[model samples]
Target: MDFVNEDIDNYAYDHTQIEDDLLWRLELETYDQLEIPQMLTGRIEGRLLKMLAQLVEAKRIIEIGTFGGYSALSMAEALPDSGYLITCEMDPVAIQFAQRFFDESPHGKKIVLKEGPALDTLKTLTGSFDMAFIDADKENYLNYYEALLPLMRPGGLIVVDNVLWGGRVLNPQETSDHAIHRFNHRVKDDHRVEKVMLTIRDGVSLLRKR
Candidate 1:
């Protein structure tokens, strides 16, 4: 089901702040080059990630999925000079696509790409992070959240993408949809953090550790 009116979505994009040149190129290139271009964070959602990183003054950020690098670059640009970002992706094509742009951006040095299962990567990672953005396989949402939670510093933020699963979360007939619904429920019931789910694009759940 359509989550929001197409006309309103178009109007919001029209009135919102536009993307920078590099981000614009990323958006276009992803559609042109990638098979699943819709996974691209796009200008609007990318901007939101950047703003959130800046708002938290995040020094260390971790991203579970690195589809074409749009979201990683967006948040990396807002990072402080010494800040660093670690993004994990299972696809080789996505890793390469993202690296090409990451190497070009001024914030490129701030990003570290890990190509593997996000759950495994999280296990190997050390130290607490200021923020984490989860956009990986829907089936592992709860696993990623559980593994990453201990790695987050107190008051750190966690941004989960596709929570509504294109509104499929309502009935959850498919495997992916049911997984998202369960993940959403887990987050809502967890006492360690407070969360708000927003209907942005597919959907986004922003959680802050308490």
Candidate 2:
């Protein structure tokens, strides 16, 4: 499951920029109160999200999942004051939990959490996006990719999380594992986008619409 050694992961965490106070509190509270706190983006991945947003000069961003609001907040922090992020979430519990943290952070104002099915939410969205992050249900990863690719501007980035699915992607058996494997290949075969898969925390795939 660990793409890198445990010691290397720890070293990477130690060397990466420390998460800000709000994010630190969010991380701690998520572990304390949430059922699957591991879902939080954590330090390294959060920093990567922030940097990716900045690299794209992202003013308009769309996020498919708003777990504990950590990832949304990280990307939103890179946005200019006028820029905004629209994040879709179907779970009422997660929405409530993430909304609380969104309210407390100054960057939260830039985030608009859309409640309901991500596919339904994606349909309602309009305009080109500079960047997008997909970290929702594994079963619909391919569907999300198809829906989002058209919305991204040329050169815009789409970040897909949990592509490795804890290494289940290698010899996929469960429905979710197969779904992720299928999604990865779908992106690989698509000529419309250039893709690169990173072995970071459960694996991350970066797809740039070409």
Clashes of each: 0, 0
Q: What would the per-residue lDDT of candidate 2 be over residues 145-205, giving only the tens digit for each residue?
A: 8899889999999999999999998899999999999999878889999999999999999
What is the RMSD, in Å, between candidate 1 and the native fold over all Cα?
1.0
**Each model's TM-score?**
0.97, 0.98
Tell me, by TM-score, which candidate is best: 2
In model 2, the clashing pairs are none
Candidate 1: tens digits of C-alpha lDDT, residues 8-80:
8888888777878988999899999998799887877888999899888899999999999999999998898
Off by over 4 Å in 1: none
Clashing pairs in 1: none
Candidate 2 ranges beyond 4 A from true positions:
none
Clashes counted in candidate 1 amount to 0
Candidate 2 Cα RMSD after full superposition onto the native fold (Å): 0.8
